[model samples]
Target: MTVHPDRLDELVRAARAGGVRGVGRRSFLRGASVSALAVGVPGLLAACGTESQVQTAESCTSEDRSAAEKALVFSNWPEYIDRKGKKMPTLEEFQTTSGISVTYNTDINDNTEFFGKVKDQLGGCEPIGRDIITMTDWMAARMVALGWVQELDMGAMPHVEANLKSDLRSPTWDPDRSYSVPWQSGLTGIAYNAKYTGEVGSFEELMTRSDLKGKVSLLSEMGDTMLFMLLLEGADPEDFTEEQWSGALGRLEGYVGSGQIRRFTGNDYIRDLNAGNVVACEAWSGDVIAMQYDNPDIKWVVPEEGLSLWSDNMLVPNKAEHKANAEALMDFYYQPEIAAQLAAWVNYICPVEGAQEAMEQVDPSLVDNPLIFPDEDFLANAYGFMELDESTRQQYDKDFARVIGA
Candidate 1:
């Protein structure tokens, strides 16, 4: 949580190279040949949180099949793993050492879409055929609240118990992360192609500036985009009343009506931004970092209002076919050496406590990178959006859809 001033200064100097290039659709694992373009994520990720779909009280029981079964399945976003050719080095090693073959699937791009696919199965306590699934914070919270995931046997996960970052320990949804573990954390902020526009310092400026009008795109995700609007309206996102939320939504409607905002986006903004068709947009920190590598003219901004913070978490779906095997994979990833390797590749804030020290050995330059290892002062300027319940989540999604014309 503390970074030395000298180290901070040096990192700042290095960061002038236009900050770190971020990861694409974090947790994304693809065919390795795909040159990870800029960040692009579906709004379905942000759309998760509504409990109106289906509800269930049945809990999935875990049985130790590890004695006979040596296989597990993991589904995550694309382009997230560390690799060498077609083989994932870490996963390969995990397989060799633990004798657990992994069926890794990068099919999870949208949290809501994935949930819809399995909700029927999970609601009935039927095996979803997957052992582990990575989800955004809000979606994971919804699953845990519905008892759709198994409570992790922490006794079998000493590495995780010892290595989880302190700040992430007590989220409002999962006080102890009993049913989830943070996979990676990211910031939602402003990203602009500087070659076409000057510094777009604040969300208010981006929303109203003439040149940026029709060229600006806000994120489709409700929490990430609406929270910034709430801040601009002088409301605290972490704890806001229904009235405050209404005011924020009203502001968004005005921009859309005025044609100042082009459209709502997930990952498609990356293509438009690269082609210079879009001048500025609401962007994720990891995506901006990744884009900067390809074009230094690309810039990420932490608006005066503050950045929205979020985490993608890992969970064991209820009635998973291989719970113990999934836990083994979870424990293996908690190893600082492995966590650092993944963090170095993905370019998000690592959630494992000791990964920073391990980062020194993997890539010394990233040791002081603020994006990878933000200290207290930097984190102070970031805030998470208001947590939502069933009725509120449904209403907010409805409101957001009307504004975005989705």
Candidate 2:
């Protein structure tokens, strides 16, 4: 989920109430005018800096405090961890067993926003006061690219190596899995109120259908919505050229121009969707899965083009005082039993390989759920967005913000 800039974590409660859950493009318009986006988005990005231009923290290091500190702060999305009335069972057990004090903060409501908060401290080779921060693929890549994150000691994370799902093993940004490890995987696809809009099987229909016009929303995340637009334009998001990005951006501009898109949003689309104020929109598979438990009108569909596959990654920020303890926690969660336990409650794609078998003991029904345990068919249609270079990411962010009038 992208997020509301001011009250970024406001959607966190909504995400937890249902379940744990949890783009683009380029230029050529260099010759053209981006009056609205150029005008409206100047301040929207006050929270985020130019990611590509962020200074690399080549000198960042923290003292070995783990032996005595014996504590770490983990910032993850809201509702991502399992809770039993003020207690996160797995985390509590980890602290008890390992004798590590853990401070868990759910303040990471959006990738760009969180980066904005910590960039200054990180760039100065200082601490952002956290040991770990879990973020989506693109932002994780940006942090890794900028050297804002610390490298993991894979030797200490043997379970991560053995149990990490094959598909999530490598991201172009962290090709060697040195800086980032996936926390959970999810699919971004077409979601709609079946009772209102029928089947929105493609982005084209969602952006053009008469009934959906003025009643539809799209994700605020550039990668999620813009990559879908890239696919809608018959381009591969995993690898595409700037010319391809320009075409997709133009198409998106047209959607907003038509007023077919009521607003660009993060997970808050679910609220409007449930109220029927929105008939259809882009959505994440997990959010739809949680919504369906109460309302049958909710539907999730992989577009004819495919599903956008992404992961929220666990990364140790540079200068973290308890890197070793943080490594211990990461390793603990990688254990299939622990991963499956977290997955059962959150209902997102689990990143552990043996978690499916582990889920059998937890919930036999989830074993066959493609959303939880994706089969070959689901894999066939899932696509990951291309990892953008720094310059490209900076430009694309501006372009996407402009189009969404953020």
Candidate 3:
């Protein structure tokens, strides 16, 4: 999920509040901001006065010490794994089975913040001390573009080759799936508190309905929020033009200017939605699914325009010493049993093809949950954002931040 600022302090506090695990499983403590989370190091490029900071194996040599080290350093978002009493069942199982000790860190609260912490090291082809880092699509793409991440040995990951879902196999940035592996995937859709209003079926209704005016919050993430705008304009988000982008941005600007939209929010929208302070809003599917467990008033809808699909990918940064061990870990998780266990706890879309049947043995309750294992028809209308070059991505992000008042 994308995050935002203003409530950043709250985001930090929430991210660090509880002991090791931070918040509850599926808790809403995302820490992304529109401007800050826009693109990977746009501000850094401007500050460093660099045209590009690209690398390759020839330019930045890497070594695989997995045979000797037998250790890995991984970083991921808080409360993202399956946990019970401070122990991650799936992770512990991996360690026990693979014998690869992992130094798992939950330090990635926001994509931008994490990027800031590592951009300096990555740009200079130095080690960021991370074997596997989980980040949303845009950040992953940026790292891949700059060649800051290592290419995976797919030959070692047979499970991934056989079980990875078709839609997730070829992201534009990593079309051949050489560098990044998805940790988890999720969808962006509309959510309305039934206690506050009737079912809100479409994005258009969320924006233009009179009674919902000033009570609807759009997502702060550019791609998640703008994909629908692109769809509403009869344009394909996966391959839109500069003209299409401009038209979509202008339409969103009109909604914001007319006071039809309440505010642009990150995961913090969960609080406003729960309190009924905001009736209907653009929301993440996983967040809405988790909310429904406690508050039946929350309802998620696949907007008429369609859904925005994104994934938090697993990447091994350049200079990570445990390349083979990291590859081992990636392959281990792709096993249908392990993937189902993770999906049962995280409640996001499972990217493994055979995980649905595996869920019958892991957790029968989740066997039929669409959010966890959506069928082909459910995802037919789902769309991903168009890939952009760094400069163009930075420009679109700047434009998006301006419209969202970030």
Candidate 4:
């Protein structure tokens, strides 16, 4: 379903007037309030599920439902989910067992644009016109702070509560997970074409080596690239302050200004790296996996300095029309067997604990891949990006635009 531009703006205006200070606070309150209202409205709950069922984290009984009945409206990135000629069994099972239908859509291509579209409405009491959305951890944190998401019902998601990675829980963004649930986790590291880079061993080798100057690319996004730079500079991302960020930005500006740097990129880095047009660039761990499928020579490395551990989470929007169904779907995905299928297909880090073993049952070869199941040693070198305050985010964005624009 498309979010009308005008309507989204109207909602944003309403939310702005409702004393919502930021995107997170606004979206959370708006989603919760709207869901609460919809639950109270006669016939609304009945239309979605049994009137007396009272859907909560603890109440989603997966029985006597059809695949089509558990229809969920999910918004995600393009090509992110598994499909076989239009069939999604994992989602289909939710429909069959819980009697909930899922209308999955992939309309979110950019995070900033998506936030801008719904910021207003979520600030108010209206549903943000979406049941669920998947976005990066940093953006999720922003939405959580604005109150644009619903606190997950852990009781309903026992599988998730039990299986989710320890590090992913109690994040600084949503200390108690009052707003979001991690859909997948991955690392930000160096992806290089071995043929072009000639035995590149570290991040510094790509950035500082004279031979590789003008051949390397870095992520244009502030969070992904800057955090990597901070780690290289020996700054602790988890404990960094505004002063440290300023220092990181300054160093990044120098790299950008010099002719030593190539272009900044996003997913295009994958294409460029695969084609040997770019030797090394900052890349998501999952994208690297996809690239490797085509070019075995491509190498993804977590620098000796360390790398960023990132998670993109699923959230129920404030203006969601089907919160109960949405919550049920969330809980359903948390199941180990179900989550394994998604992780195997998507090739991201599974949040569910036993998902790796479940995936091994499906395909034994996948169990040993570090990218899919990061080991303790590798994880020891990973750090989640720290949350930036509004002012810092604004400044960082400005600097990022300058680098990309130049």
Error at 2, model 1, angstroms: 90
lDDT of 3: 0.88
Which candidate would rank higher by TM-score, 2 or 4? 2
Residues 38-105, model 1: lDDT tens digits: 23235345567544434443335656576698989999887667767698988998999899999999
Report the C-alpha lDDT of model 4 over 16-121, residue by residue, as the tens digit. Answer: 7874466576579999999989777886655775332113323321221223344567898765776666887687778899877678888876677677787666
- How close is every model to the real structure, measured as TM-score? 0.83, 0.84, 0.83, 0.77
Clashing pairs in 3: 3-32, 3-33, 4-32, 4-33
Instruction: Give the TM-score comparing model 1 with the true structure, all chains together.
Output: 0.83
Who wins the lDDT comparison?
3
C-alpha RMSD of each candidate structure in angstroms: 21.9, 16.8, 15.8, 15.2
Off by over 4 Å in 4: 1-70, 124-126
> How does model 2 score by TM-score?
0.84
- The local distance difference test score of each candidate is 0.84, 0.84, 0.88, 0.75
Task: State in Å the error of residue 126, model 1.
Answer: 2.9
Instruction: Indicate the worst ten consecutive residues by lDDT in candidate 1.
Output: 31-40
For model 3, the stretches where C-alpha displacement exceeds 4 angstroms are 1-48
